[model samples]
Target: MTDRTYIDIHVLHSVPPSNLNRDDAGSPKQAVYGGVRRARVSSQAWKRATRVAFTDELHLPAEQLGTRTKRISSLLARRIAARTGLDDVAAARLGTALLAQDLNIKAGKKETETAYLLFFGINQLDAIIDLIAERAEELAALADDALTKAVADLPVREQLTSGHPIDVALFGRMVADITSLNVDAATQVAHAISTHPVEIEFDYYTAVDDQKTAEEDAGAAMIGTVEFTSATLYRFATLGVHQLTANLGGDTNAALDATRAFLTAFVRSMPTGHQNTFAHRTLPSLVSFVVRDDQPVNLVSAFEKPVRSRNSGIAEESARRLAKELSRAASSWGVTPLAVASVYEPNSDQNTDTLAAFGVPHSLDEAIASVLQAVRGRLQEPA
Candidate 1:
């Protein structure tokens, strides 16, 4: 087995009548899995939700996160102007030149727009500004041709890779124009799908103008139908600890902190697709984390056969199935996890016996702390 380490997280959550993720027609997103229609939430949506949680709930430093945008020129221009004491016009011009030379990106019709959207962290932006200010005198003296050449020669890739943001390091970056700047994602999130077969249900209703009383207007002002579904969803995500460490330039502490933050945020965050219409804010009924030295395992196969709800409900059945599958996999594959932790909603009918059989923690706080410690212990070990 390889020495590389990995963290796998599994979650079982149930949402009420709500359209958490929708398609183009404003219907809940779905897919045919295991020969049955299953409600689906794209990985992108959950990832965004987790990122938002990082900011809103965890209160992580904004500078340690990355931003995705096509208007990178404008973002950099404002930073350049603030740092270099240059006017907006001059700073913007310099920012455009620096990006064009370094990233090989052509500005679009709009001065702020780039050829494609770019993902960058604050650290990278600061490095670019510093480089510009360092050679301000030289740049001021050079002609257009010489200035372009000098800017191109600057170590743009090196700067971007250093002091990388936690989110950027985890999610990764891809600069089509500059392949060398690309950072492979250290995390993987699977599309959350209902454990049981799902059928879309529509709610039809009408709106009467508030200003028009019953006597003023007998007819309704508007009418529409909203699609929704309620199901127990299976959400899985994995973090490649070795890759995360590499992405953060071998900073294991930062990787551990990120892992902890992600664990809490992912469990608490809820997608707001139709929150105004259907306020279905719910937490995971079950949460599990396994730190392994082998490979990342996704136990979604447990749900391949649709789960039938009993008196305990679908969420309880889903949790039991997951725990059983995980146990079986470990026994058959000779898998040995460094640490394992789990949490179950106290009031739920779900049985915690299966997870307890694996020596998993019952408290969420204990579980998170255990996983973080395990990661730190592994990193400190000599190869």
Candidate 2:
């Protein structure tokens, strides 16, 4: 059977004035779309928030995640030292040589760091520790040069590539030195853009000096300006069920579980830029999950012309536009989705007939369940 499973998640949420993501100029990011300035949040920012949500909210165990950093050698060294009876310094030297020879990753300016950030799973690191522990006596007797040749043929690539770390599977990993270790990302996240034109606003604020005496100049403070923008944003992301399952070593069950967590986190997570000051955590006004068999449909084109407020507000209008696009795409292409679940906070009565056409509204959790059920059924089919 043909693998026809793609989960398309669409979000319509309005946020207050915030610097969720900033540019080099210390201003909220913006992009010119439809010949107008639209507030933008980079995909990288949202993806990071989602990853954190996986640990904090979803409570996934550490084994399912990957660590991305340049100090991978130091981290592996600590584990190697604990697993084997080697000292910290010896473990560090052995870890570096093995990583370089087997994985082709070289150390940077210092011996403790890699040339760039390396993303590897906990299971992958454990495999390295196991290899070191197996040859503890032989490797411990040799110096740096001898140790390098002793374990030169160990199959580190094979051990690290499998057991796809949940993070590496979704976001992907790049190995320039050893291209075979690179993992293709199973999902695509689009930079969120506002549905309407926006102008950047500045908040001029001053911090008062509490200890300054009134006799010595009354005007004593430091002042600064912060740039920000508030708008109803249309955020979009898609997950390929086939690609994700394959990334997980063809484990359909794990793929389904990952999808549930990924969708929930993507919809619920909010980036924290000046969160202590602004605390701009807003839930999506409307969220829709569409399981399409043909291809992933991005409804961002609906807002390409830029929606305007008439009776309904920007968020409400944004929802209607998205629903209409979903209907238009299905009718024009004659391709019906496998399943769809949409949940909207009905604040405004202003909506197109297509909103109801999207299907009976379900709660957020219920929507995720519905999509996951469809995905599970599809994966069970003969492939």
Candidate 3:
């Protein structure tokens, strides 16, 4: 039988205490789920920002993820048709018709609608630019005040024109689905951390916009000035041992090394400014190391919390304590074949309290590097 072990890389967020109800603006300082109080993170606050950051990493277009496909699609289609000299009904029909047809189906059915809406929105934008340029001389011949209003109202009519805005209609729909943002509900994040794998390429437009968005908007009140432009992103995915092995002709060790190399390279090259967080977010607190051997099953440790929770010196103390505990687990079992798994989490009050809830007495001092080595030795010992 193949041996398997589960590991969790817990992230610790330093949150201040608060008194708030479920319906309040603030997140729950304490709330119970599955018969235990969970350390709550606000959906609207930093958590949403993190989700957006990861989403950015995934390189999936906003249309493929967010839930506001229909609205954004309508908006984009209207923008396009108004410039093209189409009426409201025609614009809506053009957008909706593209969504129902091949525009969405080509991107894969996973988030077709959202993708279609996004495509339409982007196309609409292009069409709007073209229309504005095409009509500039005509509009300029009229009064200046009249031209401004004419340009503003132009988008509402350009939605028709059969072939133009289809891509925006499709792509916008995709963004709405993935991001869960729609006209009816305000956008909110579900968690502080989320992980997903994707294939992405360098998108210069997205990069430029990201840099621009970070700047204070000096032209917010100005007419016909630069505005927020969603940037394109590139994604690099981390793989596990099994995934690595599968991709590398079934060589487990090579897979591990490949995974490690990829991760190391990606992390090393990540931009420093991208690391800033809105709420004093710390770097990743935990690192998981997987070990596998030909040992028998049913010898796993009952305790799962990898980090020690106590005072300032929790890491060293937790490492030492885990080393001792691991030795005991190995000795109790008559056979030891071969795996050592080490999990780490930052020593934090919430995490410590969580370990306590699990009936494990852990302190910060236990997380020393020496302790990890000692525990690894015991777990890897051959019988």
Give the winner by lDDT: 2
**10 residues in a row with least lDDT, candidate 2:** 345-354
TM-score of 2: 0.96
Candidate 1 least-lDDT 10 residues? 346-355
TM-score of each: 0.93, 0.96, 0.32
Candidate 2 local distance difference test against the native: 0.86
Deviation in angstroms for 340 in model 1? 0.7
Residues 246-318 of candidate 3 have per-residue lDDT tens digits of: 3233443433333333333222222222122212223332322223232322211221332324464433343
Per-residue lDDT for 1-383 in model 1, tens only?
12488889899999999999899999999999899999999999999999899999899988888888888889888988888777787777777778777567766777569777788897789988888896665564566787777788777667776788888888888887688878999899999999999999999989988898666867889999999999889999999888888888777788788778888888889889999999999888888888998898899999999998767678877877888888877888878677888887544443557555346447888898988878887674223
For model 3, the superposed segments whose C-alpha errors exceed 4 Å read: 1-38, 42-50, 55-72, 75-89, 100-279, 289-383
lDDT of each: 0.83, 0.86, 0.32
How do all the candidates rank in terms of lDDT, highest first? 2, 1, 3
Best by TM-score: 2
Residues 317-349, candidate 2: write the lDDT tens digits: 788788889988898987678888988766544
Among all windows of 10 consecutive residues in model 3, the one with the lowest summed lDDT is 225-234
C-alpha positional error of residue 263 in candidate 2 after TM-score superposition, expressed in Å? 0.5
